[model samples]
Each structure stands twice: as C-alpha cells, then as structure tokens.
Target: MSSGGYKPVVNTVRHSITTVSKRKRSSISEPSNNHEPVVVHRPHTSLAPPGSSRKPSKSSRRRRRVRKERSSSSVDRQWVFSASNFRNLKDKLVLVSYNLLGVDNASNHMDLYYNILPQHLDWSRRKHLICKEISRYNATILCLQEVDRFDDLDSLLKNRGFQGVHKRRTGEASDGCSIFWKEKLFKLLHHEEIEFDRFGMRNNVAQLCVLEMNCEDPESKLCMQSSEQTCTSPRRLVVGNIHVLFNPKRGDIKLGQVRLLLEKAYKLSQEWGNIPVAIAGDLNSTPNSAIYDFVASADLDTRLHDRRQISGQSELDTKRSPFRNQHAVSASQTNEWSQEELQLATGGQATTHVRHQLMLNSAYAGVPGTLRTRDQCGEPLATTCHSRFQGTVDYIWHTKELVPVRVLETLPTDVLRRTGGLPSEKWGSDHLAIACELAFMGEGC
Candidate 1:
C-alpha cells in the first residue's frame, strides 16, 4: 500500500470491500420502520444441480456453533447489567479524536533521552492517558488520526482494555488513521484502506464494528422477534474515521477531499440503512471555511459549536441577565417586551441549550477563567499556530439521525513532562483533542 501519497491500487480495493460489505450487511438485517426491505446478500453456492452433495462436514458444523456461542457470550456479558434492569435505556454514545505524534524512529533523534525514552514515554503516557479519558465516557467507537503504525497503536490500546484494528502498513513516513472500541460493544466484521488520488496519500476507511444495544423491557423481546419495529434488532453501526491532507492549502483541493469523504460516507449510509453515521477528524479548516461548508452540505453532522455564543449566553442570561439596561429602558419607555424578551435579545442565544461551536482559539479565550482553569489544570500552553491564529482546528461531526449529547475539547497539557520532571513546554502532539456524545436513534444501526 502507498504510504504518504495517494495510491490508486489501495483505494480501489478498500472502496470495493466497503461497498460489498454495506450491501451484504443490509441484506441480512430487516428493514427500518419505513418497511423498505433492504436486503444485504451473502455468498451463494454454485450448484451442479438442486441437491448436489455440498453439505458441510460434522466437524465444521460443530466449529461454527462453538464460534457462535463464544461470540454471543461475549456480547451478552457486555450487556448483562442492562438485561437485568430491563427498564433503563442507554443514553449516549461518545467519539474521540487524537493525533498520535509521529512514532519514535531512530533516525529522527540523536540524543539517547529524546531518542529512547522521550518517544516511548510520550506514546505510553500521553496517548494512553488520552485513551483512558475517552474510555471514561464509555464511547462505543473512537476515530484516531496521525497514528505512527498499526502495531504501536494496537499494542497501546489493547493494553488499556480496548481493541483496535489498524488499516495502514508500517515504515511509511506519514502515519495513517485507526479506530479503537470496547470489544464487548462492537464486533469487527470488515475493514479496508482508500487512497484519495492516483498520487495522493493513502487513507483508511473501515466498517470496523456493529454495536448491539440491550433492550430495556423484557416484554420487548416479542417486539424484536415480530420484527414490527424499524430498529427491532440491535445490530451494527458504521464509523468512518480519517485524516486528510494538510498541505496544498487551496480551497478546491480541500473541498474535493471533503466531497470524497462524504461520498464514501453516503454510500455506507445507504448500504447500512438507518444506521447513524459519524465522520470526525482534523479537517484543517475552520467552520466558516469552504471546506467545512462542503462537509456540512453533505448532510453529515459536525460537532463544531460556536464557543462565543455558548459563553455569552451562559454568562449573561443563565447567571445574571446582562439585559438590565434593556429592562430599565423597557420600564421607562413602557415597551412591549418583557424582562425575558430583553434578556433573550441582550444576552445572546438561549442558555438552556448549548449548540455545537467550532471551539476555536477566540472561543477558548472567551470562556470563563474558572472553566478555562478547570480545562487546563496548570499546564504550559501551546499555540495552534506558531504566533498567530492559535485556536481549535480539530472537530467532530455527526449525522442528523444522531443527536449530540455533550462535547468537550481535551486541553493541551505538559502533565507528561511535569510528572516526569521534564520541561513543562514539551507536548505529545500539536493539535488538541475533540470529543462528543451521541444518542443513536435506535438500539443499533
């Protein structure tokens, strides 16, 4: 497979498998509430006649049943608590994005400390700490970018109670992407890698897992058996995690990349039918930029909430109503507006609801100091740009079918260095991490 730049061969194979899997999985599951029979086809046998001798051996049958029982047992254990409750539904699904800085390579470093332990420590502490925080949310799936190699990432996550599948090859200069999940929550059915152009970078796109959600009511068993509800069976959901090119700063190139990503996602959504889809990464573009516009236009939801609006509303209305002047004006002039109306207009948007903002630098600066302190926790700060435009470029987007329950930006910190007695300025990576909570429409897609 091509590493840094695009390779047509890799793209073709990955796209083909993704398409085939989508069709096959849809065929196996029943249609949604719409009653549109979307059937995914499986491998069929070519027969010499109607009753040709092609029966499976007794040993093969036994193995198949044993495998099925093992797989079912694993899934059942993951949801046994919910099975016992039978009245409470799981509320949220979380997704996280982290950039694992370039892996430690001998050629890149000359000093022993920086060469041997720095890279290894950064990988072990920084990356795994980030992973631990993500796991706290009980995220069903995670999309990670800028991973050095499949083995390193897999080893790290596997050690931390998570299972992952890496789609890229090793020894390549630029790192590829990966998806890690709780083994109990998702089953890996298929995966592939896609390249953007004939000479562009090779990217990964995988149908990594299917999450089975437990039903709340015991009587609901009959509902699933009857197949009357659209999402009767708790099945799999499709997740596409990717990292696009950072150079060639032209709008058209970035827009084209966004289009390609969305096209792939749309195809998967069609094949997966009613399964909510999410695409997350460092798109390297701001929310107002054309690249972001192209992505938003594709109908895939993004987690870019406006921080300015969120903070302004929270401070002015929720706490103390910044509209005292408006209230006074209304009282003196006998205006038709009430205190609530004045507050609504002067305080900005409503405070009860916090919309998704593009967590940019400007937004971060505007956040209350207390909250900022809580987010940072006494770490040395690193700028996004060397001197200018230091803000959030990373983001998480979701499909309309999914609702964002909560979103947070993992603060950059020198905890690794400080705890290790190293300089406080040292950081694991250049970009901040973005995380979000999503409510799946049905049990599982």
Candidate 2:
C-alpha cells in the first residue's frame, strides 16, 4: 500500500477490524475473489539509525508506566484469596491468552528498546503490568505462550485460587506454554502436551487439556445425551494451547505442527464423548494461510500429506532455508510481494473467509461478509507489533456449538502504536492478549 492513498479502516461495529497499520508498520493482504488482491506489506529492515539527536518530551515520557528498581522480594510475594472471593465462573466464561514474549535479557530486538524507545523499556514494570492485565480480565482460563518465567507466573496466580500446568520446550531454559484455570471452577480430567522437536527443527510445543466444570447445581444444564438433570457427569471443555514455530521459511513445519495438534484434539474429543473445544495460541500463520483454515477443518489432511499442496504456495521457495536464514530472505516479508502472493495474501477478506469456512468456527469470526480480522477483545485485531513482525497471530477459537457472546476490550491501534508495538508503558508483551465470552448453545442463564 502506498502512503499517498492507503489508510487503516476502522469498522464502526464493536466487532470491527482495524485493518491497515498505515505507515507506522506492517502490511496485510486483502484477498478478493474477482478483482486483483490488495496487499499490506510489513517493514523488513530498520528504516532509521538510532539516536538522531531529538529528545523525548515529558508527556511522551509520562505516557509510559515506569518502575524503578525495587526489592526482589516481590518475586517471593504471594496472596491467597478465600473461596468467597472468587469470581462467578458459571455465569460467564472468558478466556485470555497471550505470548508474553519471554524473560530473555539479550534478544536481537532488545536493542531497539534502549536505542529507539527508551521510555518503553522496563522489564520489571512490564512483567507486573502483564500480570495485572491477566488479572483484570479475571478470565475463566489463561493460556500463555512464550512464558520463560513459569515459576513466577504460577506463584503470582496461585494465590488468586488459580492452578496452572506448564510445559517447557525440550532442552531449552525457557520458551514454553502455561495454562491456568480457577481451581474452584474447574478440575483437570486429562492433559496431553507435545514438544515438536521433530524435522530437525527448533523446539515448539502444543498442550491439550480436558477440564470438567464444577457446577454448583448438579442440574446446571449440561450438554449430554439427554438435556435432563439425570446425568451426574460434569460439563467438560477441551483446550489447545500452542507456541507455533516462527520461521516463514519453514511453513511446512508450522503446518505439520498445527495438523498434528488438530488431529490429536479430534481423537481426544472423540474418545471423550466429542466434547466442546477451544484453541488459543500464537500460530505465526496469517489469517489467509491454509493452515489457519485447516485448524477448523474436520476432514483435511496435513499439508505435507496432500499430493497437490495449495495455499501459501505463493511463499514456497526451494532456495529458502529450513530456518529463518537472514542470508536467504523470504520475498513476501521483506521486498515487494508478487502479484500471485498478493492475490493469496491481499485477496478480499471475503474470499479468504470463504476458503477458511470450516467445521469449527472462530469465536470472533463475526457475521458473514466481514473478514476474520476482529480480535477477541474487539479492539484492533493486530496481535503482534514489532520492528520485524506486526500482525494478528494470536486467536481464541471455539467449536460452533459454543456460541460466542462478546469480546473483551483491547488496546486501540492509536494507543498501541504510541508505545511502538508492545512491551509498552501501558501493556506488557509484544504480542497482544485476546479474550472472548462463550456459552453452551442450548444452555441459557
């Protein structure tokens, strides 16, 4: 998109898509069925050198929430909430999930924090605010990825009457998935987690957990063979949480991991009475990719198994390294996207929607005709904002049987850009957390 003509469009509806990041960063593909596709491109390399001489203003500095070095004792701090203090979980079920980035002190993009956005650099403050954001939602379940400090997170929420399950990447110090739920409202019936250390790839993991909801009334209108109160079986839900591999070059691996996850979930669901399910994660795959659609696909084979592999072919390159080879850049992310890629990426939102139509549906898919660009929080849909990658990579999807009620409030694009894409003074995490409320189709309050 050209600066002379392109602009981000904000849908008036609450569940509107705040698409097009303008000049601040990142491009998106708007695929259409008949006409040529519209493409929004991402900023590949740094545009300017650091320290150009101008200093930041007070208001700009004030906008940031800073935390000075304090006692390390807060890490040891713990709180315990009484049973009466817990939120009512039966009436509403909100799930919030985020890629907390990580606890690594030295990262490739870490320099950008000090050199460019100095005011937005505070790891201690960022951690606190990330926990605060998670608490504010008071969601029924919290699925967190890129959680290096699982112990700290577990400790933080433990006092709030929440229990967590963590699975670290094999042979890595950090980088893992953590799933937390209110102890009083849910009981873990079964758990299956996989570490995708296959295909000579870096470690990535997916976790599936079956939770039985603790209903106050035995007859709390559960979904079973009979809609009667005769069955004493508790209501159940299956949740899939993942931190998908990030190499655009190894899309094959990403697709395979997703397919394995879906297949596992399907088999587990079938063995467990075909329970309702919800999947939350940092997929790395864009909304238009075939893998994104395949998550909800009931009968689709893995992209690796398909004889005629389609979708994302605009990006299939033999020269591309198995990993993100800086020496071998993917033209789609760095340079001008080809017309065919644009047609795949920028085709009108409707065309992608039609292709993405699946057995399961996104909680925030919204009505027909609109693209699946709305975040679970109903804010600007972009989940990630960084110098390298800025787009919606996080999602909350539920089976069609679980009707979506509403999405939580998320950070607006204007506010998000102010901090220059996450790890901001306002919110923690480079990847924005997303949440939505869901209810059983036939169950009424």
- The top-ranked prediction according to TM-score is 2
lDDT of 1 at 188: 64
Report lDDT (Cα) of residue 388, candidate 1. 17
Highest lDDT against the true fold, candidate: 2
Candidate 1 local Cα displacement, residue 365, angstroms = 17
Candidate 1, residues 1-445, lDDT tens digits: the string is: 0011111111111110112231122233544686543545777645458877776668855544333322222210011011112233244556776655445432253231331234433555566555555556566567777676667567767776567866553334456678887654455654645565432333323223334443433332212333454544555455666665554223233434555555556566566664656667656554434344344443321123221221111112324421121111112322133333223222323332112211111122211222221223111122222111233345566654555443443332222111221111233454545555555545442
lDDT of model 1 at position 93: 58
Model 1, CA-based lDDT: 0.41
Q: What is the lDDT of residue 277 in candidate 1?
A: 62
After superposition, candidate 2 runs with Cα above 4 Å error: 1-92, 105-108, 111-121, 198-201, 216-231, 296-358, 367-380, 443-445
Worst 10 residues of 1 by lDDT: 75-84
List per-prediction Cα lDDT, in the order shown. Answer: 0.41, 0.57
Candidate 2 matches the true fold with a TM-score of 0.64
